[model samples]
Target: MPELPEVETTRRGIEPHVTGAKVREVIVKRHDLRQPISPTLSTIEGRKILSVARRSKYLLFGIDDGSSVMIHLGMSGSLRVIAPGEAWKKHDHVGITLSNGKQLRFHDPRRFGLALHFTLPPEEHPLLKGLGPEPLEETFGVKYLRSACSTRKAAIKLVIMDAKVVVGVGNIYASESLFRAGILPQTAANTLTLPRLKRLTSAIKEVLADSIEQGGTTLRDFLKSDGEPGYFRQKLFVYERKGEPCLKCGTPIRHAVMGQRSTYWCPKCQR
Candidate 1:
């Protein structure tokens, strides 16, 4: 699934083209996705897009009337801007034509993406309510992370991946962040010292910012709205380097399953 950086990249890529543009048409090629397409989506037609925003991994398209369209790019989904007359490829599930003659197209090979409508105060929506603060925000500082981890005995890797703890730190970025902070993935969350938590928090922010700058890591089906694969995978230090020499200490990188997701780390370098 696309993580925060990937989702944010898509938002930035498509925002300028879609914002302020009036919707000329709304087409649902299929009504079944991870959730059934909401019939209220038809209300988007003829509305002017006010702005594009994001919460967690969902894209929020704000319209003139205060209602918004929320979209989640599932495991194999992507959004692209194409000319109205362009031939539709397989799995192009939703299309919103803008008055500017450009169309925002959603394609999800696995049909796990979503196109739904919501009222103005989208934050209160069940899907977004209680979501942890954005990782890049000041609210997600070391003190916040430490408090969230204070009572948890779960593995630090799993603890940080919890959406209620901090939004958008997915499996790939979690491994990379832990490796950078020199904390083992299996460490108990509450056992971490304040200094270590500080490092971990900084690592999370740094890794996420770097990935977003590189257009997000493309392990499989992820792509930027412009159809480019992310280049950050080339800069990965530990996430998938199992059996390879550690970049820092030259020890073989190790791999294991934590929180049911594959984790990679340098045994010598990452405690």
Candidate 2:
């Protein structure tokens, strides 16, 4: 899935093309994606996009008329911007044609992403209502994370990845963050000491910031809006490096499944 950093990179890449541009057209090449395209999406035609905002993996394009078009790039989704009448490739689900003759195309091979439109307040959207604080935001500090982890019995990795706890900590990031903090993926959330929690919180911020800077880890389905692969994958401390030597301790990294997601860690380095 395209996590926080990838989503943010997409926001940065596409904002210049679509932001503040009038939507002369809204074309739904298909009737549905992960979910059916709500009829309300048609209302965006001719409206001007004022700004673009991201929440978790969802992107919201603010319109001049107090409305927003929300988008989610599920596993294999990508967006490309090109001139009008550009050639459409396979799985090109949506095309948002702008008055400036530019079109923003949404491509999703699995059709697991969504684009929804609404005139209701953003707070009223079902997808946005209950999401927790963004991990990159100032509100998601160590003290905040500690309290959120207080009552959880699930593994520390699972707890942090919970969207209600902090949005956008995906599997790859959870493993990387725990590895950075020297916390085992299987450690129960409530069992973490204050020191570990503190370190873990800081590591989350650092890894996420670094990933965003590097344009996110180059997971198979993720790429920058401009189609550049991220460089951060080479800097990964443990994620997807099972059997590889840990950089700090020379111990081999291990992989395990937690909540159906593959988790990587260094047994000796991460205690």
Candidate 3:
């Protein structure tokens, strides 16, 4: 799945090529993804692209006609920039051919990705309205996280992974953050002291920032817009490293299910 950093990397990668370029045409191959592709996006033809941006796992291309085109690289999707002369891959599901002869292509073998056209402010868009604060934004301070998790009975790992608590702390990041903070995955949220919470908050931000720095961890079904595989997987401390030695302690990293997601943590190092 494309997490926040992967989505952000995609936004940065394609913006340079697509921005200021006029949309010459759009080709929709198979519209049904996680949701039905809106039929009106064909109107995006001829509009100048103003900007390309990302929020959470969603990407948006601002067009001159007061409308924007949105994309979500659901579990098994990838977007890439391909030259007009380049041959399309078998999984390529959609294409936005620019006036410059370059194209933005979406590839999804599983058809879980989505392409939609909507005119409402992104904030009010049904898909975006209720999202939590961005972890990398300055507004999401430790105090903000502390407040969000106050008195919760949920496991600390699950609490932090909740989109309503904070966006972008996905399965990989949640495990890495808790491992770094020395907080057990099953620790009750309300049982954490302020000091422990502070450490956990910092760990969350650090792990997320580090992942973004490495261009995001690409386990599978994810690729940067330029098609480069993210290198963060090499730096992982606990994610998918079941039974592997913990970097900080010799004990093997443990894996368990939390919220139905595989979670990794150092049993001895954490709590």
Candidate 4:
């Protein structure tokens, strides 16, 4: 699945190409995505794209007609910019042709992504209303995270992964951030001291910023809008290292299952 950084990278990659470009047409090859692509999605055909923004892992396209288009790149989805009438790939599920003679295509082999159109304020959307703060934003500092963890007895890793606690800290980032903060993934959330929570808060922001800088970690299904694979995978210290030697301590990295997701850490480095 495309995590926060991957989605942010996509937003940055496509923003310049699509911004201010009038939509010449909307084509839907498969409406049966995670959320059915609404037939009315074509209403933006004649509207100009004003801006592109990201919240959590969703891409928000601001249209001139007071409506917005939101896309979620569910497990295996990706967006690409190509020439108009470009040869379509096997999973090209949707396309938006622009006045600039470019076509924005969405591809998802697993059919788990979504493209929806709405006129309401973006934050009011049901899928977005309950989300916690963006980790990179100033609102998600140590005090905020400390409060959220104060009452939770779940494993620290699981607590941080909760979207209601903090948006965009997916399984990969949760593991990576925990490793950076020197915290065991199995530690109880409420048992963490203020200093530990402070370290954790900073670690989350740092890991995410680093990934976005590297265009996000490409672990199979993700690709930038230019179709380039993200290079962050090379910087990973844990996550998928499994039994590989820890880069910092030479201790064999440990792997386990937490919240049904693969978890990795350096046994000696992360206490």
- Which regions of candidate 3 are displaced past 4 Å? none
What value does the lDDT take at residue 226 in candidate 3?
Answer: 77
Q: Tens digit of lDDT per residue, candidate 1, span 1-271?
A: 8999999999999999999999999988899999999899988799999999999999999999999899999898999999988888989999999999999999999998889997859988999999999999999999999899999999999988999999999999999999999999999999999999999999999999999999999868988999889888899998788899988889999999876799998888888
C-alpha lDDT of candidate 4 relative to the true structure: 0.93
The digit string of per-residue lDDT tens for model 2 on 1-271 reads 7888988988999999988789887888896787888788878888899998998889999989898888899898988788778788889888999987899889899999998888888877888888889998899988898899889998999899889999999998999899899889999998888889989989999999999999888888776887777778889888888898999999988988889999999999888
Give the distance in Å from residue 220's predicted Cα in candidate 3 to where it truly belongs: 2.0
Deviating ranges (above 4 Å) for candidate 2: none
Q: Which model is ahead, 1 or 3, in terms of lDDT?
A: 1
Please identify model 1 stretches exceeding 4 Å from their true place.
Answer: none
lDDT of 3 at 138: 79
For each candidate, give its TM-score against the true structure: 0.98, 0.97, 0.96, 0.98
The TM-score, computed over Cα atoms with residue i paired to residue i, of candidate 3 is 0.96
Residue 123 displacement in candidate 4 (angstroms): 0.6
RMSD of each: 0.8, 1.1, 1.2, 0.9
Order the candidates by lDDT, highest first: 4, 1, 2, 3
Best by lDDT: 4
